[model samples]
Target chain A: MNETSAALEVRNIHKRFGGLEVLRGIDLRAGSGDVITLIGSSGSGKSTLLRCINLLEPPNEGEIIFDGESLALRRARDGTLVAADQQQITRLRAGVGFVFQNFNLWPHMTILENVIEAPRQVLGYSRDRAIADAESLLEKVGLADKRDGYPAFLSGGQQQRAAIARTLAMHPRVILFDEPTSALDPELVTEVLAVIRDLAEEGRTMLIVTHEMRFARDVSTQVVFLHEGRIEEQGPPSKVFESPESPRCREFLASHL
Target chain B: MRWSVILENLPQLLHGAWLTLELVLVSGVLGLAIAVPMAIVRCSRFASVRAFPWVYIYFFRGTPLLVQIFLVYYGLGQSPWVRDSLLWPVLSQAYWCAIIAFTFNTSAYTAEILRGAIQAVPEGEVEAARALGMGRVVTWRRIVLPRAFRIALPAYSNEVILMLKGSALASTITLLDLTGMARTIIARTYTPLEIFLAAGVLYVLITFLILGGFRLVERRLNRHLRPRTGH
Candidate 1:
């Protein structure tokens, strides 16, 4: 309910598949430079909430507010809430960049091309300008030399970094990390986590869904525990990680940590 | 049985091969033009949108090319309606009719091949493009179609070669293509063996050249898949 500082807000998100509900009503907010990390057991809908925030998966109910504008919504004939304006949805997606767990970089394009594609195509940036910015972003992620290589040629950790660079190329106001390190090998996890830590130090507003309990505790300003598709507990990392309120949250943390 | 007859008729046979190349080249390009959009539509997510293209692909693929040629050439010629239509001039010529038939015929096959390739594009990549804010058209243009074409290059090369051999059927429609020239030389010289053998040689050579051309193109498109040289 604190509207003054919140950069992104989601209210009462309810989602369902054909027969099962994935997310019950959930409310959370991240002010500027806030790092909110969601942690829970596998089927607890940790990932679904992030998907709904960007309209990658529209919630059956609830609205997402980004940059102070609520997405225009209307009811369909079948009566599910859908985005009424496609352009607005696209604009919102561009502003809210997402890093997938699988590192879904387009395999056909080289690393540099992958990094520059959305900027040139979606943002209508000139090719040279996009390339220059992409090169720098890649360099920022310590991937300047691999820019010419294909995604298949890179390691999983390297690919994840490139994906982060790709998302950063869009220059989004808020970046969502959906289990970004889950797909990485154990040894490579540290490399990707290190890059994300640097971003955290730079005052980036990020919503991360991660299983690395230690990294999550160290990086996040607010820690949210999801259980059965609902926010069971949410607070500062010190309080939630050390002395949690809900028994389920504590049990889940004990099992993961 | 005179082996010298093939040597003497080489010029005429070469001219016939030239016409055959023209038919395949024009129709193949036209077919591709039709197939690109058709394939895109063929893979539409909605069953309703896929209905028409599915039937069209089925009809062309289910029937033989010879029959398709006859339907366009003889069947259309029989209709007084077609004769009076604006397309009659182009339709009246066997050459144009053969091109039209071949274009439609190959387009169906090419579209089907491309549809499979497009569908084979990784579902994750499409979602990735969407997540990056790419519109459907831009995604198809930049990500989907280009990647699909890469995956499709080998199968498409096979289709082109088949079209080359299929162009021999053009002779049945009274066009003096490669096979047509062979039949003509047989009639005049009464030496079917030498003339047919000579024509077969030309077809094989053309097929070889087509294979090489596609190999080079495939290499260029698939350079990323291969290990980078100069290491």
Candidate 2:
């Protein structure tokens, strides 16, 4: 829960989409084996901060340090910070897995192909090695039978689990979940969350942005409450959920919880 | 409409059909080979990278195929610098000139078709590729281009059919393609109706075959989209 064992640390992230400032000076950290859940209402910048960790939506200002290495950064013409080395950013991204709200599985590829593609192409693993890694990961996520199926054929929950397996195939140091169950039908949400719960129980490092209050409270070691593009409060899940100091945090959590 | 005249010239007509098929097939492959890369360049992020290809595609798609043939054939051959250059050997031959014109023309149309298809790829799917750490080239080859090809297939088949017909212009440039061979036989035997009809029949046949080939490709590329026939 502290900085000493931090696997991923993002300091003072600021992101602007045109005139709209989405994330303003947010600092987040994930230590080894920690499950940090980000809870906020829609438009509170939870998703944007999750995306900024991998620089998928590059923060205009921030220092991202992954695996104890600081990301090489440079100032853009508009005074926004950008990754100085594209290769480095890509390399770092491989170390951080991301699961989206929409699954976003490659429709043209089978689940097995989708999972194996990154390890093979990005990490330059041999075909047999990648397939072995993918098969085992798929088995872990209970998607072993669905390996040959396409994304469209599977239900939303199944696809999200497969997406998780796809992320795990690379053995990434930390995984980011951006509302993994938000797109699922209410009945289907439990299966995907159960899969995520299993990952959390296994002591995997994760940062989750979610709307599911009970799941967050149950699974998270730490909870961060974001309000209008800034961190209203963050601490142990019990403290933030029960005795939040920030009135905004208490108001938002009470509304959702 | 003497059947005798048609029968007598059938052998010569077949030879001309063979030439037409060669022209269409080779250029179809060559043009697409050039087009895939050109389309990727056409859709680049940098305006500077986008501009030159824009002009290349514009000029080809803008002018008539006949004019393009002439530009490569007579226009280039006539230029003193071109005549004196290393390309003169290929430029001097009508066969190569026709191929050049058709290749360039089709490459432009194909590139434009693929550009639209590439852009039409779902933004989230591409974003997923980025988040996976696949580099630009790897993402394009493994994710973008294959998906684009699936979307581009129908429009691209239309381009191929148009190319088949436009290839009749090859005869106008002094190559003995299907139309050209038909004209030569008609001149000899004075049988325009039979000769023209035969050539038209052949063109329709090729069109049917092209459509069939595309259908097979579509089935293979889109097998994932089809519902499971019970596992």
Per-model DockQ against the true two-chain complex: 0.68, 0.78
lDDT of 1 by residue, A65-109 (tens): 988989988876555577888898888889998999999999989
Residue-pair clashes per prediction, in order, are 0, 0
Per-candidate TM-score against the hidden true structure: 0.96, 0.96
The TM-score of predicted model 1 comes to 0.96
Report the lDDT tens digits of candidate 2 across residue range B1-231.
587887888888888888888888888899999999999999988999999889999999999999999899889887899999998888899999999999999999999999999999999999999999998889999999999999999999999999999999988888999999999888888889988988888889889988999999999998888566766
TM-score of chain B of 1: 0.96
Instruction: Compose the digit string of candidate 2's lDDT tens values, residues A1-257.
Output: 46568999999999999999999899888899989999988999999999888878778998999988899999877777778999889888899999999999999999999999999999999999999998998898888999999888899999999999999988889999999999999999998999999999999999999999899999999999998899999998889999999998888887887
RMSD of each candidate relative to the true structure: 1.9, 2.0
How is the predicted docking of candidate 1 categorized under the CAPRI scheme?
A: medium
Per-model TM-score of chain B: 0.96, 0.95
**Candidate 1 Cα errors over 4 Å, as ranges:** A76-79, B226-231
Q: Where does candidate 2 stray beyond 4 Å? A: B227-231
